[model samples]
Target chain A: MAKKPRKKAPKPTPKETAAKAKKPKHPDMEIPFLKNVLVLIALFFLTYYLVGNVKGYKWLQERFIEGNLNKLEKFADLTTDQKYQAYFRFNHQFLTFIRDNTADTAIIYMPPDSVLDVEDKKSAFYTKKRSNSVQHKTWSTYHIYPRKLVYDREKEEIPSFDQYTHVACVDGWGYEYLEYDVPKQQRARYQVLPRTVKGLKAMNEREKNQAQ
Target chain B: MTLIHLIVLFLCGFGLMNLISPKFGLLEKIGFSFPLAHGLVTLLMLPYDLLGIPITLTSLYIPQLLVIAFVGGWLFYKQQLPQAVRIQDWNKAKSFGFLSINLPWIFLMSILGYLLYVVIAKAMFWPTISFDSVAGYDFVGKMIAIEGKVNGSMFDPDLPFYSIRSGYPLYVPGGFGYAYLMGFDSSKITTVLLILSTVVMYYALLLNYVKHTMAALFTTLFITTTEYIAMSALSLSNVPHTFLAVAAVVTIFIWMDKRDHRYFWLGVIFMALNVWARSDGIVFIAGTGLSLLLFAYQEKKWKELIIFGAVSGAAFMIWQVYLSGTLGITNDGVFVDHLFWDGEKFDRMTDLIWRVITNTQFYGVAMIVIPIGILANFRTIHKQHYHLLIAILVSWLAYTALYYQMDNGGENFGYSLKSMINSSYKRGMFAIIGVLYFYVGISPMTQKLSQLIIEPGNPFKPKQ
Candidate 1:
């Protein structure tokens, strides 16, 4: 009684199954070996990019030179690393100080340096609450604020006594912004504070420490 | 508050995404990608704006957003869910080597790098201080975040020196408003997330067509590492525009492959979003939509083509009407100054833009790679990959023409040209990413690549 012979299944080809895969030839890659090496080299550079160039970790490492910075919670407490960031990381120390501490209401006196860290200036604005009435200057070296005093108005040698609460000075050696903590209504004279600041030694002790 | 803000926004976004994802068949198409996140978050502001939903942190707005979230969530859960599989053996799982070498790895690395940068940038930089951030974009964003809606007082020209662009879109601010509503404080966080969503969504879009290795390489080199992309990814209108552009192209690519209407809907949504982001997005949407129509016509899908064309045209027209009504159609002012281009001015701008292209920064590698990739795979571009190329060319050519024709109406032709180039050339040149993506797709020799990188009897490419 006729059971037709069962059809045999076809064996799968190696191309269709698990086998050694062929190396693709890109038109951009005339030589696969060279392309592989180049790709590896590119990968190395990419790894280097993540590790070296970002500067985020480098700045962080400088912060933690030998088991430290854990206690440096306050910006005032961050003296050692702060100065290091100033001299080393292009005024990031001073910038960080301005950013974390400088309130939007604080009238700050910043030095004239167009080439300063623009990102730093931008960061300082985070401390600010956007005021609709006060139109911000777009590309000022000083942070976005209602009152940005580029220079003291008197034009004297020591500059005139003014109402700036902070003096952001960037001299030949490094940068530091000396903040005067005084009563809100009363303006602090720049000529009467302790010459030495946080034991790091203020850059311009005479001018910076000039408190009255 | 920051954590809570992020969590609430995340939930709202994902819920909208779930609804959107199911509708578009995006999850079904891509097998669980994060394109939905980009789709939802960037898009959350739209319905609010269009439907006159005032953005506030109060129970009123919160409840509205949640209603959407819940409805979406309900639909998502109610759908035909994937059959649950019992974990019997660990032997069937793919190797780490295969997984690590592909597109997801690139996305993982880029996301990690972005998070690291976001942390540092958040620590170091205030986004509001950037020029564009201060001038036109996030200034309003700051307002919306704090005020929970547009502060009409600020926009009052009668005030002293009100400097915000009147015609600028509110998505950026509205995006930030969503954040502040969730109780987040900083605008920088919103900026960071916008940039992050952009890269993630673009990465998902890349995986739609390209081999994983190639997709990873293109993303890292062209989209992720480049400072222009990194910085501009969330800056102002740039990220939104990029997202919509990427989504539109990828959706078309998906539609091309699957011949489905669901992808068409997503593509149309993205195009609508593009027009909503920036005025220039009109050109991009029109170009990509036109390219899609041509593709549909080629495939002889008359119904699909006509439907897509009608929907997109209607969306564009509606937005145009709204913009004209509110913004006012200007003739001899800011709008007219840009619209009219003298031949001499065009020539001068052409020279300037040529110089800009030649002296590319941050994206210099892409500038070189894109041209070479195109030339090397000229055959592939002409024959097999013309649709994507057509999209790129249309967008690039239109944007390029825009840059040339847009004059500040200055007497000195040179300064106007230079200024135009300065403002636009970098952002406009972002259209090159499309050309580069299509090139990588055609160039990678992907079948051979899958075999080399993936394991034998690989689940991703079992037939090699």
Candidate 2:
């Protein structure tokens, strides 16, 4: 049998041609104004999601860290290394403790970490000027004088502390103590900080002399 | 702060750039939009030394005074400021029945802009928290700001730390000091503006090639969400450097693809200036140049090849001359790459690779999508694309290799790995983000995948 006459496709209407011309190559690109709006709305939600992630990051930092960035809680119980990390954040608290409790004549020894590779006290001074920070140090440094002699602790570098009646360790990290040397053989050591003249007779006498 | 000093200075600079190079008609295409304004600002800032005076409050403020006087004179003589500066392209487009990104859309853009402002401002106020910023980058910047010149004490030999940072490129610090001279003494302001300019410039750049949506998406994703850029908000470390790197790559590609001389000169300048942005920027610039040379060779563009090679080679020499001559920073010799065989080199390398590819902070799902997207659209890639791909790979790999040559090996292998993970990984990631976006943009499957997720039931969708 002869092949049936092939049917011709109908020509597209003008409206159809316009629609075809306007059609996007990718479906996602269609209704571009709408797509842009939707993508942006999704972005808003995505930002919130990222913010949540930042919160988790902050939380992780807290769990692994101690001291001020760790909420400045009592870190007397943490290990030395843990306390070292805590000291990295608690320099502010250390300054506060020194200003509040210790004698202005008291000198502090702050041991710098070799890992940080800081050369000397001047290094932190230049680095921390913008923040008005105490020598770019939250770990340990000679930047926390406030009204006391804060020395870089290298044993030989420290001056004789015999002239000062009181010694306070305000690093807020490991080995925290404030002690007043008594006239006699005995020494008065405080188990806790912010300790006033309840037990030490010599400290009370020194305070009275200062006030007078 | 009048804020208008900043306004007038930047506007004058923008006008000046347009006057200098009318091609691309930056102001015409984008108007006073973010990208155009940013490019003009960057051009002014990059060669800011041409101002040829000590950067002091008086010096910077005086220049603004001069520009304002000039603009004021022009306004009186011409009876108008040009429409380009008076209005942004977005404000003058015929989209959605009115000019440019209209209505609630503008409101939406405002919200986004405000959020970025808040972030940038916070970073500005925050103290230099990162080691690199504190020890080297900002330290150099603050000294220059204080002294009103590039002080050589930044190269102090007593401190080993200064030695490490002494070789750091000074253009960024110079930019910061210029802002400081303008009495804005905030590194945050300088760094944030640099970042905003970079983002805007890159966006303007892509608009020259891609569709508007693709360009928009790429800018939004690549610029806004990159973790390192966010991490760098408080410092001028990587973001500033990355700007020049991306500009170098993008401009070269634009030149090769479009055969535009504007792009060629622009890319060459970017390459030369990239060295001034960061020491490692040469890796990106050189990689792009190598790719371009290969491209030129294949296309048999002999004169173009000679010109490109000569310009780039001279630029490198000029950079060295400026460094040793004007800056007085002598290289301490080749870095003892002893850490090449140090602990966990292989392991650290692997971790870095992981961080670059899988880090959700910057690329989001892009890492997963890009490779699969490429595989799905493998046939779509042309010869020209292969050349671009080589450029991208070289830039990314060159840095990864340099990571091995560093002395970052800490106490143990894990410590070494952590060190690599900390900063080096971010640097490498910055190199690839733009390139990966381009690849994904060209990939056919990336579009289909987006359609599948974002618009699942379009009537225009073809049946399987």
Candidate 3:
């Protein structure tokens, strides 16, 4: 008996053929250039808006910082670069210092005005008190986000500043309800800030001049 | 003599009780060890009441030792006790044993080992006060002991602002509340009873899942290895209830399989015990009852279904009555008083799910085995294991949802989520795990392997 012929697969319909043919050579190109540009703009503005306004992201960042600080071990071995980076990163400079120095005694400078906000409310320093335009000022003042450092463990601590009482500033971010070790002896009773790099530079300069 | 001496004396007393226990019938044998341990510990504390020993390490150690001695003796006696019913050594038990019982045992061992290292060597108990235990089991346990009844206050303090109505007693296998009610100091009894109940719970869980005695023992070993389970057992909260929940699930599933109404009653007893172990148990009771009805439906046993329905209904109604009449609580606040309606509650619940999904460690290491098992028998899933797995997953989902939304308007989602699982979701998922294991252990594939080797060529072979 003759073997039954296998049925040939149906040919593609014109619509299917056209659809397949019409597929973009670079598939992503069909996304309009203008739309792409708009998206980029939107994302930029969106990130800016969210970062500036939403309290949730800020809270998460703070928690992330707290978590990171708690995880840090052996601060004495940090690179000078790492020390500066960490110093610039967290709101809790004192904790960063403790983590770095493993200090037997180290001072944390808390401005008398640095009362911790224990209540689950937005820091007054950020909200309510500031004008919309000026809120960014307060936001910039605190290291509001956690920065994951990729520093060698051995190169974490370096004495960069001559004002080395081996102190770390642990910014409570106004949540004093959270606990960390900060000895009374190590605390700076006064917080002096024009809090700018320039201001710090000026203070260093003044100290140098006085020493001279 | 110091408190240590008193504890040593208590240890001797407990050993004595265990020896005498075997003679006085089953209940007496089962229960006798508890009294000597609890009584001695209670007496040791009396000096604090009478002579006022400083409430320090030595003082706490005294009671802790007394309790441990009792449990140790109980364990010793259990080892000596003959296997309850020597089932003819069907190789079926051996084959299914590893997944059901051995895996839990191994898991428990590794966990306990790590925890010991961390706690003893590193002096680390990070994120202490086990999260889930504080909210559901531990706090409520204290309340039960203090008030001598399950009350609004049992769910209060944990979620003071929220008015929830889902309060049930501890649902863990080694039910803390049951032990507490059986006349152990709520605070002092927790460590001892939890450890003891954990062993019993594991054996029971294994019995339902594994067919072979060795396999059951192996599973118990796995449970002991699990750090989370070990940590949980020691805490005042979730571990005990989680164990109980698993025990209840295993017991009922066994009842279904065995068609033994005695197992059914045992299941009910465990379920009722679970109710007092944790607030989430109320929802569990409802879900479990629904699942049992499905089981009855599958078996075409209307009589069993009706009986189960009535018993489940009576159990729930009793708790409801207690809540409404005795405790003066509303439906929303009987068990856990989490803020359910609030947005924050929803967000936190979502966040918790996200965290669990994201965290690799949260799902125990043995999780890898489960997928492999499923993959190996993917074809059988729809025909055999689907319902069981589905029931367990659904129960977990339901319990999580209840806990996620238990607070007041989700206002305190952080608090609510934390309260529900308390520390971790491990304890909350205990019952579901037990259900999953029963399916895993009793899978046709596993059971068939055993039957093939043990009772080969027997005419009355179970059909696949």
Candidate 4:
């Protein structure tokens, strides 16, 4: 009853060996439901704790959650003009005022940046250092589109400088170009006046007359 | 009515996508429709404005409807109408306990939803106020809408008040014009929709290579890039251009990997639109072109290379012809005619680029995460995605080189080269951020990690 010679197991072919390596270890293994749940919970908590400790997280939370969301909610009830005003402030107001006062086809004479940037306590116009929105030609044109703007610097370049239909008076710069005198009380810091030139006075002439 | 208009636009894009290829997934179809439709609309408006056709909502809508009809008729004739998802499949998916099995998805979805809501609300609640938009794109768009012509008052030489940015391509302005023509009070809706389309398409594209969980996770990461998300709410061309560039490169990469002709054609369309979004988008085109050329050489497919180069370069050529040939506008002299080496300029550009790219405050964990992912999978990197790596590197180098060669001495529109680097260049990195995250998402290491978490004991594999 001696055992017959034991048969050696057949060697795995190359294809079988490769397939075995590729196959999942536990093809029928059930998902470890509790383990996955616990791991996920740990991961969520870890991420929460890690992100909470970062300095950037506070800024993000404040900027996006507290600040932007609240601001958006508040803005929900405002009109489009109010919303524009909130962002553009006085720039929008001035431009809209110009739009209302001038015709669509009117050519406006704008003050030079130098004049607009002058610091006058009694007549505070936009300064380039403080704000460029109103000082920016394209920005102003966008606000009052279909109306053209010309500056003193462009006076030499633009032959139609003398033909400007209106003057955007800022810091009383354009008053000298006006034909009639605006009474002291009537003159405001910012005004869009019709460019009447029946008796335009040069600054030098006014200075000579004052000296006399 | 706005909703109806949006629906029409989406359908128009959906029909176009179906006509291009009926093999797209549901999410892919939904994600790509709005942008394709929007891009086509902007392109259509160009010819209309040039040919003296009044750009009314009717004018745009009728052509789109015809597209839909033609797609439907063609598909019906070919008997290749797209198969709808069956109810039984939905039931099977519903019964799979997806919620319990994929908790990461829930977390990622919540984050993405919150960010999207905030961005959309911010965009909708405010009018266009960004300086560039107000002075340039929005201004031109407003003029176009009011005058019903592209060559209207805004382009008058006598006015001379329009910003240099107004001379850039008409995508953003046309978008604004389209919104206005649709009777919307605010053009910000277009911005909002574009953002939505970008996010959706990004996620859908990721799903092709990764599982749902990984796709959601990386897509969340893509949107959360701080400066990018901040700028997303503003009506700028950068964010939208980012979408086109990323779509083009990624689709081309997918085509390389899958050898699918549909992806190839889609990639070509996006690459063309990339330039239409902004002329500088040619950097992306050049980058992807090199990749395609390499693929063609390796596979001996010269015809595909010819097709891609000719089609992608068409938009750039057309835009140039319009600007210089048709309008007789001289070159702005932004770049030097010949390349020169300035150590100071090179160093300054690279230093700033490094600072911007690595600044965690701007890019969150992406700059850190991407490198770590690459290193972890370095052994298999060459085998899987060397083409994509080359594309990213070449495009980035070309972009930086362009800036280096720019004549930064004179200020244009109050923007010096230094200022442009800090702002425009910083914003332009949004495209790179997107493509990098996408690459990392498809990397083998990420796939393995995803499997370990989602289903332990299962072998790691790509979704395909």
Report how far off residue A183 is in candidate 1 (Å): 22
TM-scores for every predicted model: 0.63, 0.64, 0.45, 0.88
Runs of candidate 4 with Cα error greater than 4 angstroms are: A1-32, A53-57, A118-123, A126-131, A159-163, A179-185, A196-212, B82-101, B328-331, B411-414, B458-464
Taking the tens digit of each residue's C-alpha lDDT, what string does model 1 give over A1-212?
99999999998798866543453322221223443444556666665565355443333333322113233233434343453343234333343455444445344455443423233446322223232111132223223333233333222532332545555443221123333343434332221122125322433443365652
Query: Which residue segments of model 1 deviate by more than 4 Å?
Result: A1-42, A45-212, B21-54, B59-127, B164-166, B229-234, B300-332, B335-343, B411-415, B442-464
For candidate 3, report its TM-score.
Answer: 0.45
Scored by Cα lDDT, where does model 4 land?
Answer: 0.79
Model 2: DockQ score: 0.05
In the order shown, the candidates' DockQ scores are 0.06, 0.05, 0.01, 0.19
Candidate 1 residue lDDT tens string, B315-427: 55654565456434332333334355478866777787666665434354555667776666665555655666777778777877766554355342333557667655666
lDDT score for residue B117 of model 3: 35
User: Which pairs of residues collide in model 2?
Assistant: B124-B188
Best by DockQ: 4
The TM-score obtained by chain A of candidate 2 when compared with the true chain A: 0.29
- Give candidate 2's error at residue B169 in angstroms: 1.0
Q: Candidate 2 at residue A200, lDDT?
A: 50
Q: Considering every candidate listed, which one attains the maximal lDDT?
A: 4
The DockQ for candidate 4, computed on C-alphas, is 0.19
Candidate 3 stretches greater than 4 Å from native: A1-212, B1-192, B204-227, B233-236, B331-355, B382-387, B400-426, B444-464
Q: Candidate 4 residues B1-464, lDDT tens each?
A: 98899889888898888877878776777777887898899898779878999877888889998988898788878777634222343454555543235556667778788888888878877888788888777887787777888777666666567666786677778888888888888888888887888888999898888777778779988888877888889999898888889999999899888888888888899899888888999999888889888988899988978888998899888888887765556456777778788887778877878887787777777887899988988999889987898788899888887787777765433456678788889888899889988889999999887677666545545555
Candidate 4 shows a clash count of 0
